[model samples]
Target: MLNQFLDNISLPAATVTSATAEVQYWKEDLGGIGTVRAVNGVEVTTEAQGVISAIHFKSGQYVQKGDLLAEIFAEPEKAQLQVLDAELRLARRNYVRIKALLDRGVTTESDLDTARSTLDQVVANIEVQRARVDQRVIVAPFSGVLGIRQIDLGQNVSPGEAVVSLQQLDPIFVDFSLPEKNYATVKSGLPVILITDAFPGNSYRGKITAVDPQVDSASRNFLIQATLKNPKQHLRPGMFAQVSVQIDAQRKVLVIPRTALIFAPYGVAVFVLEPDENGDQMIAAKRFVKTGEERGDLVEITQGLLEGDIVASSGLLKLRNGESAIINNQNQPPENANPKPGNS
Candidate 1:
């Protein structure tokens, strides 16, 4: 009789947190590693070879378009310009005197013409001299933040030598590549998100601005460009980034919290709660599941789960198949499909 009583003994209910399987729209995420690029970036170079005389801006300085950046030694050119100016003034006076003489019949028209030609020649020479002087000055090509000073004052720089780098940071661009198979799905106006290790836990939102018409021959990947607002100017060119884009139409799928699933060598399973034969207690029943894609804290259930099914989200290890479970959700926080743990 004691052995029979022992066989009929019942175990207490196990406490577990529960989550409900929900039906929601799901989209496919396509992603690739990319590099951040400035919308407008260049190495500010010099056109004239000469020794630097003055550097008007500091390193990493913000400048407007046409702002003076540096100047090359041009004392000789300035002196030459002054001499040309004096010669032009003299030629103008001679031209005026010859014209008056011609009008009074004191000189021939040929003399007046010769004086006029001299005045025109001097004016042209002065203009050429001014242009020569302008070549020695270096100005910003566009409004941007300047990089370090490449050439010091009094240092000689060759023509086409980089003086500094200028980059426009607002509305930056990010270049990425995707497999050519996805070319038809990607185009201008598609939304993209970018994440970088430089700024942890932060993401940038933007849209596709351009897509290469042809795929790369070697890699079979097509190039894609995206534009993002960078008002703080934090994103720098050449920074490594991970970019993702959602493609295809949204479809309805059953979503559940990842904690609810139990993974074994055979397959995945979940503890689904059901009303016991007594009708007053709940029982945990083991059910095999077929999972699809996972995004953030949520997992997609392709099969074995129905909408509004209550499953064990926590305390899975503490419960056995057919074990009784106590519903204790007071400690279980709400489930979020896309959870930002840092914010929490």
Candidate 2:
């Protein structure tokens, strides 16, 4: 009965059509979720140790560079400055008097020189004291939003102590990693599409700004940073994100429905259909092909096939090379006939 069925069965002929060739660049996605962080974040601190005499700005306030955020107790330094001013005035008076006396030959040039030196030393001391007093106050280093205040008014803070944190939020960074195998494909300035669970239906576009030169030994992945412009400050730091880097678009390539290729022990092969003499259609030949990569329902044919070759999309297993076939071009299969698991 099986032999009779095989004898009655006839192979179907596929119409020959020219296909445009494309060169597709494919990449494997290594899953890693990262947050949107500022490219520059720093804590502003006082340069000199002093008690916070006054806090000028509240927590979470936006501040500009050189804006006064806090002021330390500078009363002692003010008092010292006043004393130095008095000393400088007295030294200048003595120097003037000595210069006049020396010019009139009433005193030695040595006395005039000593008085000038005294005035210079007192002026230098005043400048030194002024610098020391200026160090008591803390100011914002850049224009950014200030974090929560770490010290309260009247609280003593040591040098290098954190007064508040500042972060530039206008432009943020989406940092992620890709496997070492994909390192060659990722380059600076490539466009990246960013998606986050925090904000659904909204996608932020960015470009690759940096790529780590060395691969991580432990994870065997290379680090990449993409800069995303956040004008509205909607995206915050530590927000989980999904990033897609577009390497390049595939131009033109000879592709077939992925289901058309039959995998066998010998090699991957596809049945091509052609018309024989006397207007009879048949599976003209079985050609072994080398497939490069697959995308969606299409597979690229790198070799063993021409542009106009037609291949069987269904019922390929029962057909053999040179078997007689009937031409059935109608009832075409769907565009994406070969559906894989988990692929929509």
Candidate 3:
């Protein structure tokens, strides 16, 4: 009866042997939200106004350079070419006959010169007509995938009107911005990785291809572009991505398990262990600590903690200031602070 009463009155000894803090390497990485875009994207347009007689490319089809995409009505230009060709043949024969007569002393120099001038004039006119005819046929400027067509067959298209969109997909671009404070760390050739919701568990590796020299005065941030090889072409334009870059190779930091932290309305703190006044027992002391980056199961402690300090990793609420703590090493938590849900 006496032991049961004492146990009920006294504070139950909390399980204090489960958790620990260790000094480890904490790498500092910079990350920002970004957008994925095609390396070469353009809205294809027409230079000549006419009815779209035919569309040679299907929507989303891959086309090669110089492949015909569409054709505008060019009956007038074709007929003009035919007329010019006939005129050119006549002029060529006349020039040859005049030259032969001049050599034989049968034709005057002025007549031969007129014939030669007529031949050259016809040739120039033919070239101009051929150019007009070529403009009626729209061809792909580069190898790429064609987007949906804006104009349909038999539709009258105006000059400079967008007909379709083309985008190169073999390699893609990712555009992201970083704060001006990181300008010194970011540069062309720096490695980066991108994560997107479309592919949850995959990461695409890339390298910084360009960085804006001038920072935006309003935001104090500069833009950077990265090139990623998309052999599988899984990535597409306008996709939101999370960009990550390692700013420091090795960053020495003091880290503790996340379970050691005690969050409250006032501030964040932790329970640290120190020797009691009698030096015969250890007591839990509430220490207010300033934290920085958090990763997995570990968090960075920038202040109010030492590298080898002993802290209460769990049951922080039960352990308060001046509370006696029994340091039992049996069944301690894993040294790796990183959480592995798969292990559960």
Q: Pick the candidate with the highest TM-score.
A: 3
Model 1 C-alpha lDDT per residue in residues 1-344, reported as the tens digit of each score = 99999988877789998989989887777889999999889999998889999999998999999999999999999999999999999999999999899889999999988999999999999999999899899999999999998989889889999999999998899999999889888889989989998888889999999998899999999999999999887789999999998675787889888889999999999999988888887899999999998877889999999999999999888887887899999988556767778654
TM-score for each model: 0.72, 0.63, 0.84
What lDDT tens digits, residue by residue, belong to model 2 across residues 174-252?
A: 8998889888888899888888877777888889899999999999988999999999887777788988887665445
Better of 1 and 2 by TM-score: 1
Question: Cα lDDT of all candidates, in order?
Answer: 0.91, 0.79, 0.86
CA lDDT of 138 in candidate 2?
A: 81
Best model per lDDT: 1
lDDT of 3 by residue, 1-344 (tens): 99989866756555575344556776666799999999889999999989999999899999998999999999989999999999999999999999999999999999999999999999999999999999999999988899998999999989899989999987999999999999988888888989898987789999999999899999999999999999988889999999998664767778888878889999998888877788877788889999987877788888999877898876666775767787776655554644657634
Off by over 4 Å in 3: 1-18, 97-117, 263-267, 275-282, 325-344
Error of 1 at 176 (Å): 3.0
lDDT of 1: 0.91
- Stretches of candidate 1 exceeding 4 Å from the true structure: 1-12, 27-33, 75-135, 178-181, 193-205, 215-221, 239-249, 342-344
**Pick by TM-score: 2 or 3, better one:** 3
Model 2, stretches more than 4 Å misplaced? 1-35, 181-184, 217-220, 251-344
